[model samples]
Target chain A: DQQVKQNSPSLSVQEGRISILNCDYTNSMFDYFLWYKKYPAEGPTFLISISSIKDKNEDGRFTVFLNKSAKHLSLHIVPSQPGDSAVYFCAASLDSWGKLQFGAGTQVVVTP
Target chain B: DVKVTQSSRYLVKRTGEKVFLECVQDMDHENMFWYRQDPGLGLRLIYFSYDVKMKEKGDIPEGYSVSREKKERFSLILESASTNQTSMYLCASSSVGFGTSGRNEQFFGPGTRLTVL
Candidate 1:
């Protein structure tokens, strides 16, 4: 069973526009959510994260909104840049012990 | 910066061969994990270690074994390689502190793509 799901396989947006990626989870035990961005042939880099207690967390141009009631979360990048083009993965964990469950990634393309 | 390194960037091996993939972390992290990435499947965990000489099986640990004799190294072993096992392998490490909620970001290595012929 897929505890976390990223239904959209790919997304495209214009540079200087906004890009939104969505994720859903079936497990209620997950209290932490994170987003990672990966480039070709490289490991994923951390982007943003949100706790279950908070509805939203922002880091510069990246913002993560969490809705515990809906069991969903989203990563929004405003004024997306060409450098933001990469695969984005949504992940969740039950506690702080380091075991994370990851969703199928979404390929984001920012066009000039 | 937290750095994770894998033994190989790409490898080709014949079926039934014993394959060993090595990973090392310079961050002295308490947690290390191994995962396999396949098209449309994303990353599937194979095993993880929270401390030296301790290991736990993850979602997909079948046909795989792991060793963590020292704190800095984690190894994945394939007793008998199979074509289906061909995939990109990733190693990640994280430090989990008390009351941290396990949200500590994991640093991953540039994956190893293994092809079983």
Candidate 2:
């Protein structure tokens, strides 16, 4: 069974628009979440993470929001750049376990 | 920078041949992991090591084995390679790992695409 799921397989946005990616999980035991961005022919790089205690965490251009009660999370990237186009993966883990369970991934394309 | 290096970026081998994929990390991390990536299946863990000579099997460990003789190096061995095993392999390391729960947030290598014919 897939513990994590990303319903959308792909997303396309024009330059300088908001790109939103969503993820859901079935395991209630999970309390920590992370997102990774991967380019073609390269490994997935860590993007951002949110603990279950917080509802949102924001970096410079990336923001991650979590709703523990709903078991849902979303990532928003504003003013998306061409370089932001890549496959994004959503992963989840329990607070104590170090292993990551990843979703299939969503391919983001920022067209100019 | 905590860099993880794999021995090869691409390789081809014949069926039934023994293959060795090497990985080394310079970060002095205590955790090392091997995972295989396929087109639609995403990345699946094969093996991981917490310390020297201590290894654990991940979700998919059939037909594969691993070794961690030293702190910086981990090796994956295919006793007899098969076409089904052809895919990209990734090695990762982290300084802290989840003890009973398993939490080393993984830092990965570039990856090796292995093909078996």
Candidate 3:
């Protein structure tokens, strides 16, 4: 069963605009959520994350909002740059657990 | 920087061949994992090791075996390679593994794409 799901396979947005990637999960036990960005020919890199305690976490232009009651989360990149164009994966895990359950990635393209 | 290095970038092998994919981590992390990436399946875990000589099976572990004799190295062995096993193999490591709720993020290596014909 796919516990974590990224419904959109691809997305396109203009540079200097906002890009929002959405993810949904079926398991309520997952206490931590993370977003990873991957470029071609490279492994994924960690971006931002949020815990169940908070509804939102922000770092610079990137923000992650979690709606634990809805079993959903979203990653928002404001003023998205061309460098942000890559496959974004949403992952969930229990806090302090090394094993992660990942969603199918969304390919985000930022146009100039 | 945390560097996870895979032993191979690409490999072509015939079916029935014994395959060994090696991964090395520089961060002295205690947790190492092996996963296979497919087109729509994203990343599927095959095996993970929390410490030397400790191992656990993940979602897709069939036809695969692992060895973690040393903390810095984790090896994935395909006992008999099959055509379906052809995919991008990724290795990751994390420093935190003791917590039951959550762990530190993992550092991934450039994947090794294997094709078994």
Residue B67, candidate 2: Cα error in Å is 0.5
After superposition, which runs of candidate 2 have C-alpha atoms over 4 Å from their true positions?
A95-97, B97-104
Two-chain complex of model 1, DockQ on C-alpha atoms against the true structure: 0.63
Model 3 RMSD, rounded to 1 decimal: 2.0
Go through the candidates in order and give each one's C-alpha lDDT: 0.92, 0.88, 0.91
Show model 3 residue runs off by greater than 4 Å: B97-102
- Model 3 residue A81 CA deviation in Å: 0.3
Q: What TM-score goes with each of the models?
A: 0.97, 0.93, 0.96
Per-candidate clashes come to 2, 4, 8
Query: What share of the reference contacts survives in each candidate?
Result: 0.60, 0.42, 0.60
Candidate 1 per-residue lDDT over residues A20-84, each given as its tens digit: 99999999999888898999899888787788889999889999999998999999999899999
Against the correct fold, how does model 1 do in TM-score? 0.97
Best by lDDT: 1
- Clashing pairs for model 3 are A94-B101, A94-B102, A95-B101, A95-B102, A96-B102, A96-B103, A97-B102, A97-B103
Per-residue C-alpha lDDT of model 2 across residues B38-85, encoded as one tens digit per residue: 766667789988889999998899999998999999999999999999
The iRMS of the candidates, in order, is 2.0, 3.6, 2.6
Compute the lDDT of residue A8 as modeled in candidate 1: 98
